[model samples]
Target: MNVMVAEHIGFCFGVMRALNIAKKTKERTDKPVFTLGPLIHNPQAVHELEELGIHPINSLDEAPGGILIIRSHGVPPDVIEKAKEKGFEIVDATCPFVKRVQEYARKLCEEGYRVIVVGEENHPEVIGIIGHTGGKAEAMNKRRIPVIEDRDRIGMVAQTTQSIENLKLAISYVVERVKELKVYNTICNATYMRQQSTKLLAKEVDLMLVVGGKMSANTSRLVEIARNEGCETYHIETKEDIDPAWFSGKITVGVASGTSTPDWVIKDVVEYIKNL
Candidate 1:
């Protein structure tokens, strides 16, 4: 079997920065370090961090006195304030792109534009961004953008991991109805590159393997993109999830992983396919 890897795969800059901050803090401090949430979407990466003495605590109350590193997904400002009130030293590892979206959304809200965040409603990133707006923003998925009120001005921002196509479509939904539509294309460049690369690679391979956490939004998006290109795609977290039967009659396989996926996991998936 010929195994082809996407031009862009594995950890992106944002995930790498978060991991570095967590690992370095673990190495330098005697204080127990806790992440406000899973540092990234990849479970294997979080487990590895745990092995290195960096723990993930879901809530501020769960953390003992120590440094609290905010995950790359970012959190609402109130979360930082509450953690500070609890006396935990904070290290914010929010992706710069995500922070930009939050800032724009907040500014839009303050300027009196109805804020519309284009992303999954329940996604941590979207929730965090909405918090910046004092919980006054609306998060919607690609299928529908809810019409809460007819307004003259509306501002739109996207979750950093959202597809550019989705952002554009969501903007189109509001463009005509609203007298003035403001939008910030806050989708990370790396995300666009990866999605495009995945689409291009998917067309050349018989079977497409998307290796990342099942909960990873970007990884799921990659699977959707591959399938949209008329290719059979599987989203797997590890080599163990690879089904040998799926490789039957497949001459060429394409491998693509999400931004949060570690290089080691990608290598294992690739090597497993080679052996098959």
Candidate 2:
């Protein structure tokens, strides 16, 4: 069997930046360094950071002092404020694209337009964006936009990882409901390229393997996109999750990974496929 891998198969710019910041902090200080959440969605990456003395804690209350690295997903302004109040040194590692969305949401709210964030309601990125809007914005995953008040103006921004298809559908639903609508395409360039590459690969290969953490929203979306293209796709975090039997009768296969995925994980999975 022949195997192909997506051209963009590992950590994107934002994830790389966040990891570098964490690693640099570890190099300089003996103090406890805690991340607001998993530095990135990949478990292996987070585990690697832990080995270097960087820890992931869910709440600010749990971190007593030292440096706090905000995850790539970014946190609300208030989260940073609270951390500062507690005397923790802050490393803002929020993806620049996500920060753009938050700023757009805040601008829309200030301009008197009802803001709508187009993405998973429970996603940290979406929640962070909403916090920028002072917790008054609405978050909708698909077409389930809430009944709007008598507001005529509406502004929409998407979670940085959302697929264009999902963003467009959400916008279509809101377009009919509001009179004056503003839409900002906040999906990062890296994400858009990865989605396109994954879709293209799926059509050319007999089977597809998407590698990344299950908790990664973007990784799950890649699997969904491959399946939606009618290709047999499996989402796996590591080479151990691969089933040799799945490769039976397949002449060609393709591998793609989420932005948070590390280069070593992809190389291992690809090597395993070649050895099979």
Candidate 3:
């Protein structure tokens, strides 16, 4: 089996920063550490953190103990407040890029612009961004831009993982009609590089494997890109999940991982395929 790995596989700057902050904070603090959700989507990584006494909790209602670590995607403001009120010191690991989107969305809403969060609804990042806009932020993600005929002032902010091409298409959909248009090109540079490199890799390989947390949006996007190239694609969280049958006949295999993925997981997956 011939295996080729993406040039950009594994942790991007944001995920690295979040992990470092969480780890460093955990090392220093005695208070039990908890993330509002999985710090990154990889169970192995989460389990490692758990070994160090860090845990991920699903809801604020369930979290009345320990220091609360905000995931890479910023939590809702109310969650933060409730955490603080509940006597949990907050270690915010929300990516700066995502924080910027929240700020921009809040600013746009304050200025009376009809805010549109050009991203997935219910995603932690999008949820935080929308909360900033008082829930007026309509989702224009995944090639689904709606008809906007009446808003005099329209503003757009993208989900950090969204592709540049999709962002442009969404903005273009609204540019001509709205008298005032505000676009904060919030697509993080890490996302763009990963997206471009993944697409190129997809074209060159017979089959593609995207590795990351199943809950991770960016990893899912990589799978979509490979599928768009008309190649067989699989989205796996780790080596154990890989089906040998998928690569049974393919000579060339390409592997790409999401920003949140760790390098070791990708390496293990690639090595498994090569050994097969």
| lDDT, each prediction | 0.91, 0.92, 0.86
Q: What is the Å distance of residue 231 in model 1 from its true position?
A: 0.7
Question: Candidate 3 residues 203-225, lDDT tens each?
Answer: 99989999998988998888888
Give lDDT tens digits, candidate 1, residues 170-234.
88778868678889888888888999999999999999999999999999999999999999999
TM-score of each: 0.97, 0.97, 0.94
In what order do the candidates fall by lDDT, top score first?
2, 1, 3
Which residue pairs clash within candidate 3? none
For 1-276, candidate 2 gives per-residue lDDT tens digits of 699998777999999999999999889998899999899999999999999999999998997989999988988899999999999999899988889999999999999988888888888999899999989889988545677654678888888889999999888877877678999999999998999999999999999999999999999999999999999999999999999999999999999999999999999999999999
**Candidate 1 local lDDT, residue 244:** 95
Residue 191 Cα positional deviation in candidate 1, in Å, after optimal superposition: 0.8
Clashes of each: 0, 0, 0
Model 3, residue 116: what's the lDDT? 90
Cα-lDDT of candidate 3: 0.86
Model 1 scores a C-alpha lDDT of 0.91
Worst 10 residues of 1 by lDDT: 142-151
Q: Which stretches of candidate 3 lie over 4 Å from their true place?
A: 142-145
